[model samples]
Target: MLERIGITNFKAFACQDVDLAAFTLLTGLNSSGKSTVLQSLALLRQSHEAGLLDEADESGGFLLNGELVRLGTGQDVRHESYTEEDPDITLAVVKDEIRYAWRARYGREDDLLGLLEAPSGPTSWATRDLPSLFGHGFQYLKADRIVPDVSYPRSHDAAVRRSFLGARGEHTVNFLRAHQDDTITAKSLQLPEMPSTSLREATDYWMQRLCPGVNIETVGIHGTDTVRLSYGFGSGVSASNRYRPTNVGFGLTYALPIVVACVAAQPGSLILLENPEAHLHPQGQTWLAYLAVAAVSAGAQIVLETHSDHVLNGLRLAVKDGRIPASATAVHFFRRNGQTAEVISPSMGPDGMLSDWPKGFFDEWENSLEQLLD
Candidate 1:
């Protein structure tokens, strides 16, 4: 697992070291650098996947655009008020006790920021010895995911071989179609209310948390390169009736990949999510946090960026209930300071009480209540 992340001259951060745990929640104000943390990891994963961080190679470096992330040119990523005259964007991850840092030169127009120095380590970053960010079970889901569509593309290589659901979860339908019958090995991720522990049934169980009695169907389109996803609503005593994705509301389709991603997580897996609360109702946000907690209990590490107070409370409840330890979780509140973003981390106690609640940290509910009572 990543113990901490060191980022300098990257986007909203000038030089900051963010501590991480099994499950880290990044919260706070809009555009205050919550997303920047996730982007830094995604950047390295995308860069490594492109073979830019190969051991002997020094010319190739961080790829600005790729499957995992599209960060645009160097100027777009470099901090607005970089401290140094020669801007060097650095990203480091501390796994175990070793710190692996990668420095790249800032190019005005170059998409590939050539390496300024090799990744700081005995061996290259991509070697099997180290805890790699680009592992088989890694997933990074952006906030803007696939919407309600008639069909989605089916990529066998992506869904089956690579086991990737795509950054926007574009391949989720195909992935579900392939792994529906696979048994979920994690007990924490299983749904006791459901009849079976298969991926499909378990997934339906979680989606029901978002919308009761909601079900999903994924199948290949005949003679086409795509797959179809439909929703079924369980009514009074009969079998659920099928409906197209368009007919169903957007929330179910939007939250499917999240359920799949959490359930499929195995030990040593790394999942990064941005705004899992997007399009979700209050209750759904809480349930989503439960699913994330379950993933952590199953041995996967999650770094989530969210703005929902409900999501924060759910995680707190998880810690209180002993589903996860308070030490295993970290909550970071980010606030803007001029050109950079500053983070304040509040520790969770076993009773679900936070050690400190910064001024703007999930206090909107109380703030509004105070106004109404006055």
Candidate 2:
């Protein structure tokens, strides 16, 4: 698991180190550098996947624009306050207690920033022992996910060969179509009320948390290169006719990728979620958090970026109920301090209470209540 991440001279940070846990929550104000942390990891993964981080490849560098992220040139990613003395960008990760660091030189118009030095490790970062970020079980779901559509792309390479759901979850429908019948081995991820552990059934069970009795269906159009997703209400003789994705509640289709990602996650899977609470109601957001917690209990690592107080409270409830241990979770509140961003981590106790609740750290409800009472 990735225990920590260190960023230097990167976007929104002159230098920052954020500790990670089995389930890490990144929350803060808009543009406060929450996404930057996720982008950094994606950038590294993109570079490594493109063969730019090969062990003996001297020309290896950071791939800025790729399937996972589209960060612009070096000037766009380099911190504005970087001093001339140390103008290079650096990213480091601590995985399994070993520190791996990389330094890249800045080029104003170059999207692929050149490497300035080899990684600070015994072997190159691209060896067979690469970080789990580059592993097959890694999934990065961006905030702007797929909307309700009649048909989604069908990519055999992406869905079957690579087991990828696409960075924006554009390939989720096809992935579901291909893997719907696959068994979910992790008991924690299995819905207790549902008898079958198949991915499709579990997805339906979880989606019911958002909209009760709603189920999903995915199939390939006979002559098309895309897959279609439809929703159905009820079951057996009382079942309603299947409805197209556009005909259902918008949140159902929008949250499908998240449900599939968590339900299908295996041991050692790494899921980086951006605003999993988007398009979800308060109750749904809390349930989504519970799903993520269950994924963690099944041995998957999740780094979630969210702006939902309900999601936060749901995680606390998970800890209190013994669904997951407090030590397995970490919450970081991020905010801008002048030109740079800062992070304040609050620890969780066994009873689901936080060690600290900094100003602007999901306390708006109380702040507003006090004003109203006055």
What does candidate 2's lDDT look like per residue over 192-297, in tens digits? 7997989999999999998999988899999889998999999999999999988887888888889888998888888999999988889999999999999998
Query: Per-residue lDDT of 1-374 in model 1, one digit per residue for the tens?
Result: 88999999999999999999999999999999999999999998888877777543556788989998888898899998886664889888888787888888889898899887655444454656444386788899999999999999999999999889999999999999999999998999988887888989989899999999888889999999999998888856865778998988888888888888998998988999998888888999999999999999999999999999999999999988999999999999999988899999989999999999899999988999999999
Q: Candidate 1, which ten residues in sequence have the lowest lDDT sum?
A: 123-132
TM-score of candidate 1 relative to the true fold: 0.97
Candidate 1 achieves a global lDDT of 0.89
lDDT of each: 0.89, 0.89
Q: 51 in model 2: Cα distance from truth in Å? A: 0.6
Which segments of candidate 2 are over 4 A away from where they belong?
55-58, 120-127
Give the runs in model 1 whose Cα sits over 4 Å from its true position.
56-58, 120-127, 235-237
